[model samples]
Target chain A: AQSVSQHNHHVILSEAASLELGCNYSYGGTVNLFWYVQYPGQHLQLLLKYFSGDPLVKGIKGFEAEFIKSKFSFNLRKPSVQWSDTAEYFCAVIPLSGNTGKLIFGQGTTLQVKP
Target chain B: SQTIHQWPATLVQPVGSPLSLECTVEGTSNPNLYWYRQAAGRGLQLLFYSVGIGQISSEVPQNLSASRPQDRQFILSSKKLLLSDSGFYLCAWRSGTTGNTIYFGEGSWLTVV
Candidate 1:
């Protein structure tokens, strides 16, 4: 069984502030990584995905995540955040081999960006 | 383009009542379908998944059960509802091809009174 751990359960930041949310997964094999965001009262949307060939992946709304295999981490980051960026973010993963598209998701981090 | 639809966007059922939620996918074939429950302030917990028609897999033993009568149609049902079942139920689909990107439907809010 694979599991994801999100270190930051809740985060508060002012507009234009840099942001970083920690995510780590427990899987040894090759995996596909993803970050999804859910705005208040909105469905979950894909922010970005990492299949292969890139350790650093950039996503929508100026968000990015770096996948470090050695540390089993894929941390989401944004240089500058806006008030509209307030949402719940989820980190997910799927093993590359023998995967039936079952995605293991983290507990999620709530980001509150204040103006 | 592929899209997923789940019926009864909001449901309020009484304890010991029955539940039946339907989900279907369009614009794709032989895709994998899944059912997940999201409790307040928690991550999405996968309840069931299916690879093909009449093939279902259960992740956790709970009061819910899932079935796939058609390739793109997935159903979640419960014989008797429990208060613990109150949460947001989401239906998602993923292409069985190369990439592993899963797309979610507009979740159904279930409230057990």
Candidate 2:
């Protein structure tokens, strides 16, 4: 079974602060990783995804994630975050071998940016 | 551009009453559709998915069920609602056959009172 884990439940940061959210997954075989963001009152939007080639994947809104195969981690990072960047971020995993076509998500991290 | 829409932005239903939620996708064909439930402070829990019309897959065994009547339309229903069903329901779609990005709808808030 593929599962995702996010250690940080709530993150508080000031404007222009660097941000990094930890995400880890448990899958023995090939896997696909993704990060999704949800603003208050908005739907979950795809921030980025990693399938095959690049270990470091860049996403929308100046966010990027690196897939560390050995550590089984794909952490979301941003150089500087704005107040508007406050939202809930989720880490998801899809096992390549699973035929279910379903994604397993982490508990999620709530990012609160204070200006 | 592909867009997914879910109806009834918010709903308040009495316990044991019937429930129905609809989701439709536009600008895409034969999309892989999914139904998910989000409880407060919890991750999105996949409930059902469909590869095509009349095809459905259940992920979590619950009081909810899903159906794909059309290529772009997916419906979630429950014969009798339970208090545990109260949460945010989301519909998502993927463009292609395998290994695609999943996009979500605005989501529907259901409160089983």
Candidate 3:
């Protein structure tokens, strides 16, 4: 079974602070990784995705994630975060070998950016 | 541009009541659709998915069921709702011909009392 793990449960940061959320997946084959964010009273939106090629992928809202195959990790990072960045972040993975296109998501990490 | 919509934004249903949640996708054809449930303060759990009309897949054994009556429409239902069924229900879709970047709908909040 494929599963995702996020190390952080909650993180508090002041505005303009650098941010990094750890994500790891358990899969042995080719995998697709993604980071999704759900703001308060908003739907889940795709932050970024890693399908092939570039391991470092940049997404909307100045967010980026790097896929490290060796460690099976795809950690999201932002050089500077604003108060609007507060939301629940989820890490997801889909193993190509399964061919089911089903996504396995992590428990999620809540980020609170204070102004 | 593709978009997915799931409705009744919020619902308060009594236990043992019937449920029918509808989801539809626009601007895409033959897309893969999925139904997921997010319990309070928890991760998204895959409930059902469909590859095409009349095709459905269940990921977890529960009192809920799903159906795909049209190529772009997916429905989740239950004959009798349980208190545990109260949660946030989300509908998502992914391109069948391109990358596997799944997009989620606004989500529906179900509160079973």
Candidate 2 yields a Cα-based lDDT of 0.91
Give lDDT for model 1: 0.93
What range of 10 consecutive residues in model 1 chain A has the weakest lDDT sum?
A94-103
Query: Candidate 2: lDDT of B52?
Result: 80
DockQ of the two-chain complex in candidate 2: 0.64
What is the Å distance of residue A41 in model 3 from its true position?
A: 0.8
Ranking by TM-score: 1, 3, 2
Summarize candidate 1's per-residue lDDT along B6-99 as a digit string, tens digits.
Answer: 9999999999999999999999999999999999988888899888899898989999999999999999999999999999999999988757
Tell me how far the alpha carbon of residue B46 in candidate 2 is from the true structure, in angstroms, after superposition.
1.1
lDDT (Cα, tens digit) per residue for candidate 1, span A1-115: 7899999999999999999999999989888899999999999999999988879999988999999999999999999999999999999888766756667889999999999
- Candidate 3: misplaced stretches above 4 Å? none
lDDT of 1 at B37: 94
Better of 1 and 2 by lDDT: 1
Q: Candidate 2 on A1-112: residue-level lDDT in tens?
A: 5679999999999999999999999988888899999999877889999998989999999999999999999999999999999999999987777455667789999999
Judge the docking of candidate 1 as incorrect, acceptable, medium or high: medium
RMSD, every candidate, angstroms: 1.0, 1.6, 1.3
